[model samples]
Target: MKAVIINTSTDSELVSADVVELSNEFNTFAQKTAESILAMGLTVAKAKRLSASDFETFCKLIRYESDSSAIRKLEQIGKRYDALHRHVDKLPSAWTTIYRLCTLDDSAIDASAASGALNPTIKGSDLIALCGAAKSSRGAKNAKSTTARAPADSAVPNGTDMVVRFTTTIDETQIVTLRRVCKLLREVDAEIALSNKLDAVLNQAVEMKEAA
Candidate 1:
C-alpha cells in the first residue's frame, strides 16, 4: 500500500512512503511504552528493595502524581496495547478509546470488535455500553435459578402519599458515602425518613444563595 501524509501546517499532501514509515515509528513507540509499563507493574508488585505499602512515597520518589493513577495507566497500556496496535493502529493517539477498551477482558474486546458491537468511531459511551451488555448477557447465561415476582398492588399505604422507584448510576466512592449516610441517619433517628432529608436539602438549596 502507498503511504499518505496530509500536512495540515504546510497545506500539502505527501502520498508515497512517509505514511508507512510514520506508522512503523508509532507502532515501535507504542510497543516500547507497553513493555515499559508491564515492567513497571511487575516492579511495583514485587518490591524487594522498596516499600510496597507506602504507595505515596513510592510515587513521589518516581515523580508520579499518585500510585493508583500510575497503576491504572500501566493496566490500560498492558491490556489494550496488542488490540490497539493490531486493529486500530491508524489512531495510535486515541488514548480515550484505548482506556475504554481496558475495561473489558481481551476475549470480550475481541468478540465485540469482531461482532460489530463496537462502533467504527468508538465513542467512550459506546464501549461502556458494549462491555456492560456483554457482562449482563454472560451473567444471564450463568444464572442457575430464576425468581418470578407478581405485580405489586399499586395502592398507596394509608399514611404514605406515594412510592417512587428509579434507576441511576453512582460512582463507587459516592455509593459508599451514601450507604454510610443512610446508616448514620437510621441510627441517629429511625423515624426521620430519607425522603424527609431529601426534601429538607432541596428546600435549603432553594433558599440559599449561590456560592461566590
Candidate 2:
C-alpha cells in the first residue's frame, strides 16, 4: 500500500549498519554507568526511566527534587525514547526515571494515518524529544530520552556505607503529579527494599568481571 511505501521512505536512509552494533554502544554505556551508579547504590530498582514531553511530570518530580540536582537538569536535555534509567533509592535522584523512558521506544502506527505512522521525524535532539514525548505519546508518542551519557562522578565520598545500591521496583503512576514532595531514601530503608536484588547483581557483576 501507499502507506507502506511512506513508511519505507520515512527513515530516508534505513539503518545501514547492524542494529546489534548500535546496541553494543548503549550496552557498554549501561555497564560502565552501572559501576559508578552502583557505587551510590543507585541500581535498577529505585531508579526509573522518565518521560520528556511530560513537562508536568518533569516539573512535579523536580519540585520534589533531592541530592542529585543534576538529574533534574539532565531531564531538560533531549534524546530518543526508551532511554533506560538506572534508578536508585534517593541517590542518583528521582527524575532519572525520565532517562529510562528515553532508551526504550516502540511506536509503529499505520502510515496512512494523518498524524504519520513510523517515527521517522525522530532524529537527533528531536529524536530525544520523541523519547520524552512518547511517555504520554498515546498516538505513538515516544516520551523518554535514551542517549548514552558518561556522567562525571556525582558519587558522594564514602557514600557506599551510608547507602546500599538499589534500583526502583516501586510502582509509581505513569503520570506525575504537581506539587509533590520529594522523598529521600534513608539508609537501609525497608520500603525501598532492594538489598536482596543488589546483592544478586553485585555478585554476578563480580563473576563476570573476573571471568572477563
Candidate 3:
C-alpha cells in the first residue's frame, strides 16, 4: 500500500482512495469489527502523520465526528497492541473496551490477559474499573509530593464536608451530549477529575448567585 502523505494541498485523491480501501476492508470483516477497527487505526495513524490539521482533514474526509476521541483511541490501540497479531482473537470486540485495555500498563495488560480478564466477553465498565484501579495504584505509589496534595486539599473549603452526592437519570441522547461536554472539559483541563469539574460549575453558580 502506498503511504498517503497529507499536505497543504490535502491530496484529496490519495486520501479518498485510502478511505475507500479501508472502509471496504472493514465491511468485509464486519463480524470481526475489532480487528477491522485496529486495521483502520493503523491506516489512520499513517495517513495523518503530517500534522494535527492533516488529521482533522482526514477525519472530515472519512465523515468521522470532528475531534473524535474514537480516532485517537483507535490510533493508540493500533500503536500499543500492534505486536499481538496472533492474539487479536482474544481481544474484546468493542473498540471502547480495547481502548480501556490500551490505557493499562504492559504489566497490567499481561496480568489481565493471563487471568482471562482481557477476553472478548469483558464489559467496557469492567475494563474501565480495571483501568481506574491500575491508575489509583500507580498514583498511590508515585504520590510523594506534599505540595501536590496540598493544592487539591486547599481547593475545597470543607474537604469531605463540602462533598455532595446527587443522582439523576439521562437518556441515551443526553448521555452522549454529557460525554461530549466532559470531553471538551478534559481538553480544557486534562488533569481535572469529573468531580472537580462539577465542583467548578457549582462554584461558578454560587458566585453568580452572590452577584445577583
Candidate 4:
C-alpha cells in the first residue's frame, strides 16, 4: 500500500480486550479448582479414620483450619454428599446454602428448586429457615402419629380424673436439677408437717422477743 494505515490505538485496544478475556478465564479456572478441591476433601473425609486432633492437623496442612467455618460446612456436605449432590447444580454459590441443602432429601431439594428457593433473590439463611419449618412440620406429624398409637395401658382409670398435666420445655441439666429440687422440697415439707417444726420455730422466736 502506498500509504500504510497504522492505527496503533486500535491494536492497543485489541490487546487490552484480549488481556481482560484471559484474566476472566484464569479467574474462572481458579474458582473451579477451588470448588473441586473442597469437594474432594469432603469425599475423602467419609472414609478417613482420623480423630478430631488428626483432622485438625490435616486441615492445617491444607491451609484451612480444622475448626474453621468453611471446614465445618464442608464436613457436613461431605458426610451427606450422596443425598445432596443430586441437587448441587441448583444450590447457590455460598457454603451456607450448600449446607442447608445437605440437610434435605432429594424430594425436598427438587421441590425447593422448582419453587426457586435457591435463586439469587433468596438467601442461604432463608433456605435454612425453610428447612426449619419443614422439620417442625415433620415433628408435628410424628407427634400426631405417636398420640394415635397410644396403648390401652396409657388410658386413665374411669373414676380417676386425668392427672393435671402441662408441657414445658427444659434442657437436660435443668430437668435433672428440677427433679432433685422437687424431691428435696417434698421431703422437707413432709418433715415439717409431721413435727409441726415451723410453728415451734415461730413460737420460740416470739417467746425470745418477749423475754428481751
- Which candidate leads in TM-score? 3
TM-score of 3: 0.50
User: Residue by residue across 108-170, what tens digits does model 3's lDDT show?
Assistant: 777777777777787878888878888987787765442233444355554542343357888
Q: Which candidate model has the greater TM-score, 1 or 4?
A: 4
Clashes of 4: 0
The better-scoring model by TM-score among 2 and 3 is 3
Q: Of the candidates shown, which would achieve the greatest lDDT relative to the real structure?
A: 3
Clashing residue pairs, backbone N/CA/C < 3 A, model 1? none
Task: Judge candidate 2 against the unseen true structure and give its global Cα lDDT, from 0 to 1.
Answer: 0.34
For candidate 3, the 10 contiguous residues with the lowest summed lDDT are 144-153
Task: Tell me how far candidate 2 lies from the true structure as C-alpha RMSD in angstroms.
Answer: 26.2
lDDT of 1 by residue, 1-212 (tens): 46465455547655434333433333343433424334444344333233343443344334455546655565455445566444452222344455656666767767776776664466667767877887887788655223322236555444343343347898999999999999988876855666688989998887785642
**Tens-digit lDDT track of model 4 for 1-212:** 12122234335222233223322332343343324434643543542345454444344334566567766676676777665555556556655666666677666666777777756446766887978866777789876665453454676554333443358888999999999999999999999797897789999999999999
How high is each candidate's TM-score? 0.37, 0.18, 0.50, 0.47
lDDT score, residue 200, model 1?
93
Taking the candidates one at a time, how many backbone clashes does each contain?
Answer: 0, 52, 0, 0
Colliding pairs, model 3 = none
Worst 10 residues of 1 by lDDT: 18-27
TM-score winner between candidates 1 and 3: 3
Error of 3 at 176 (Å): 46
Error of 1 at 66 (Å): 4.9
Each model's C-alpha lDDT? 0.53, 0.34, 0.66, 0.58
CA lDDT, candidate 1, residue 168: 89
